[model samples]
Target chain A: MYQLIDPILVAVLLLNFAALGASQLRTVIHAIALQGVLLGVLVVVAHNEFTIWAVLMACAAITLKGIFIPRLLFHAIREVSIRREVEPIIGFIASLLLGGLGTALAVLFSNTLPIAQEHVGSLIVPAALSTTLTGFLILTTRVKAITQVVGYLVLENGIFIFGMLLVEAMPFLVEIGVLLDLFVAIFVMGIIINRISREFSTVSTRNLSSLKE
Target chain B: MLISQIIVHVVLLLVMPPLLLGVIGKTKALFGGRVGPPLFQAFFDLIKLFQKGSVISSTTTWVFRAGPVVGLATAILAGLFIPFGGHASPVSFSGDLILFAYLFALGRFFTASAALDTGSAFEGMGAAREVTFSCLAEPALFFGFLVLAKLSGSLSLTAMLDGPMPNSWGAAGASLVLVAASLFIVLLVENSRIPFDDPNTHLELTMIHEVMVLDHSGPALGMILYGAAMKLFVMCALLLRIVAPFDSGNIWVDWGIFAVGMLALAMVIGVVESIMARFKLTFVPTFLVAACLLSAFGIILLLR
Candidate 1:
C-alpha cells in the first residue's frame, strides 16, 4: 500500500517545484490540476480498502480539482488575456530555492509529529507540508490575482493530502463539504478576477493598491 | 591488477573526453537533422591547433601562457583523486576531497588570471562572470560532498563512494537521487555547457568561458580544449560513480560499466543542450542556486 502511494507523493512534491519554477500562468495551472488529480488518487490509495465512500471522494476530488477548477482558471486567463506571470515580486529562481528550503523544512517538521504506524516512514506528511509551503510561496511572491487563486487551490490540495491521513476518523459528508466549499470559493474568486480585470484593465494586484487612497 | 587498472583508468580518461565531446556534437546534430562534425573532429582540431604557432599579446605577461598549462595540469591532478566505477582512485586519503575540489578552483584561478592578463575588456568581463558563477556552483558541489560524507561517514572520496553498497541505495535512495541531480547541474555549469553558457557560440558578447580564451591560439588553445575535456571527464566520472554504484567483482565489468555510464551521461548532456536554450545571464545565478538547494535538501534528508 505504501509502496504505491510514496512515489506519487514524491511526484506531487516535484510538481510543486515545477509550479513554483514555471513562468507561464498556464503551466502553473496545469501543474496544480495534475497535483489535484494525484491527490484524488492518493485518497483512494490511502484508504487501501475499496470502500464506496473512498471511491466517491476520489471521484469528487478528480472532478473538482482535475477538471472543473482548471477549466475555470483557463477560462479566467483567456478572459483576462494574460499569458505570463511576469513582473513577479519574487523571481522564478528565488522561488524555486525557497521551494527547496520549504521541502527540507517539511521533512524536518514531519519528523517531530507522531504519525500513524503504517504511515510513519512514509512521505505523506512532509509532502503535504511542502505542497502547502509551495502554495503559500506562490500566493505571496506572485502579483497576479489569478495566480493567487491557483496558489489557493494548491494549498487546498496540500490540505487534501493531509486530510487523507484521517480517512478512517473523518466522515465522508465533511470531505464532500470541504470540496464544495473550495468550488464555491473559487467560483466567487473567478467572478472577482473578472471584475478586477474589467475595472482596472489589469489583473496585477499592484495596480489594485492605487484604489486604497 | 592494480597497475593494470590504473593504466586503464588513465588511458580511458585521456582518450574518452574528446569522444564525449564528439558524442555531444553528434547528438546535437542528430537533434537538428544535420550530419554535423565527424566523431574524431575534436581530436583532429587538437592536432591541427597543436601544430600551429601561438599569437601572444604584448600586454600579457607569462600568466597568459601559464593559464592553459596550469588548467590542464590541475585537471589531470584532480583526475588522480577520482575513482572510476568500483576501482579505487590512484591517490586517496582522509580529507582528499577538499584537495580534489580545490584543484579545480586552482585551475579556475589561473584560467581567470590568464583571461585578465590579456587586459581586454571582453576577456575581463568573461573572467568576472566565470568567477561569479563558480562561487555559486561551489556550494552545490560541497553540499553534495556533505551528503556523500554523511552517507558513507567518511571524508575520503574513494571510501565515501565505494562504501555505498547496492543495499545503501534502497535505504537512502532519495538523498542519492537529489545528490545525483545536483551534481549533474554542477557538471553542466562547470563545463560551461548549454543552459549556463554555450560552447559553440563564437559571438564575443554572449560567450562566458570561450570569450576568456578569445586571444589564445595554436597549442595554448589546444591545451585549453584538452583541459576543458579533461575537466568534463573528471566531473562526469564523479557523477558516474554515484549514479552507477554497481560492482560486479570483476574489474573489467566495472570498468565497462563506467565507460558506458560516462558515454550515456555525455549523450544526456547533448540532449539537454539540444532541447533547452541557455538561461539569460541574469538567471544563471538562480539556476546555480537551485543546484545548491537540491544538494542542501539532500543533506537535510540525510541528517534526518
Candidate 2:
C-alpha cells in the first residue's frame, strides 16, 4: 500500500497539471474523472485494515464522484450547445506556471511540518495541498460556469486526499456530508446550466454580468 | 586506448544517426498499418541526395551554403560531450554542458539565419517560427540542466549525466522522473517530431522546420537531413543517458546497451508521434512552458 501510494499521488499531481493546461472542456472533465477514480483507490489503500466498509465506501465514492459527476458535466455541456473551448480569465500558460509554483511551495511547506510516525514519509500532505491549490487556481481563473464546477470537483478531491491522515478519526457521517454537498451542488448547477442555455442562449458566466446589481 | 575510444565515438556518432531515423520511419509505418521504407532508407536517401546537383540561387549568398555545414558540425560537436551508455564522453570539461547546450542554439542560429538569407518569405516565416519556439524550449532545456547539475553536483555534461547511476535513482527518483518527462518533450520539439512539429508534413504552411530547408537541394540538403538525423540522435543520447543509466562494468557490454537504448528511444518517439496529434500552433508554447515548469518542479524536489 505504501509503495502504491506515492505513484498514485504523482499521477494525481500530473492530472492536476493536465487539467490546468488543457484547452478543451472535455479534457479538463476527463482529467477530473480520472483523478476522482484514483482518489477512490487511495481511500481503500490509505486504510491500515481492510474493512468491508472501506471497500463499499470506495465503490460508492468511485461511482458518484468518478462516474456520476462527469456524466452530469458532459450532459450539461451538451445541453448548453457551446463549443469546447476553455476561456480562461488567466491564460493557460500563466495558470500552468502558477500551478507549478504552487506545487513547489506546497512541497516546501509540507517538508517543514512535524508529521506523526505513520504519515511522516507519505506524500499525501503535499499532494493534497498542491491539488487543492491547482483546483482553486482553475476555479478562480476559468470563466465558464461548467469549468468552475469542474474546479470545484478538483478542490473537493484535494480535501478528500487530506482526509487520509485522519481516516480513523474522521467520522463516516462527515464523508457522507461532503459527498452529499457535492451531489447537490452539481445537480443544482446542471439544472442552472440547462436553464441558462434556455434563457440566454449561452452559458458563459461573463454574460450574467448583464443583469444589474 | 584513449585514441581508440575517440575513434569509436567518432564512428558511432557519424554512422548510427540515420538508422534511428529509419527506425522511426519503420515504427510510424507500422502504426499506419503499412509496409514502411526499408530500415536503411535514410542512408539511401542521403546517398541519392549527395549524387544530385544543387541549384544555388543567384540571389542567395554564402550563408545559404554555410547553413547545413555549420548545422552538421555543431550537432556532431555537441555529441562529443554526452556520455553514451556507461562510457565517459571523449571530450568533456567543467562547464561543457553550457557549451553543449549553446552549441544547439548556435546550430539553430545558423540554420535560421541561412533560411532568412534565402530571401524567400516562406523560409523566413519558418525561420521566425523556429527561433520563437526555441526561445520557449531553451529554458526547459536549461531547467533540465539545472536539475542534472543539482543531482550530480557537477557542471560538465559527462559528470552531470553520469551522476544518475542506479544508486542515485533511488534517492532522487521522483525528480529524475520529472526531468525525463520534460527532456522528452524538449526532444520532440527540438527535433521537429510530431506532437510539436511533424517532420514529414508536405504543406509548407504547417511545418516549421521542413519549410525552412525547402530552398536547399542535393548535397546541401543531404547535410541538413544528415544533420537533422544526428541532432535527433544526439538529443536522444542525452535523454537516454539520464533515464536509462545502466552499467555492467564492462566497456563492450555498455556499448551494446547504448545501441539498444537508442533504438528503444526512437521507437518510443514514434509511439508518441502516432498516439498524439500535433498541438495547435497556439498551444505549442503552452506545452513548452509546461515543460519548463515540469523540470523546475524537478529541481524544487531536490531542495528537501
- Interface C-alpha RMSD after superposing true interface residues, each candidate, one decimal: 2.1, 1.5
Pick out the ten consecutive residues of candidate 1 chain B with the lowest summed lDDT.
B163-172
Worst 10 residues of 2 chain A by lDDT: A78-87
TM-scores of all predicted structures: 0.94, 0.95
Q: What is the DockQ of candidate 1?
A: 0.56
Clash count, candidate 1: 0
Best by DockQ: 2
lDDT of each: 0.89, 0.88
lDDT of 2: 0.88
Looking at model 1 chain A, which ten-residue stretch has the lowest summed lDDT? A204-213
Task: Give the C-alpha miss distance for residue B81 in model 1, angstroms.
Answer: 1.3
Q: How far in Å is the alpha carbon of B293 misplaced in model 2?
A: 1.7
What is the per-residue lDDT of model 2 for residues B220-285, given as tens digits with 9 covering 90 to 100? 999999999999999999899888999888888888999999999999998898888987888889
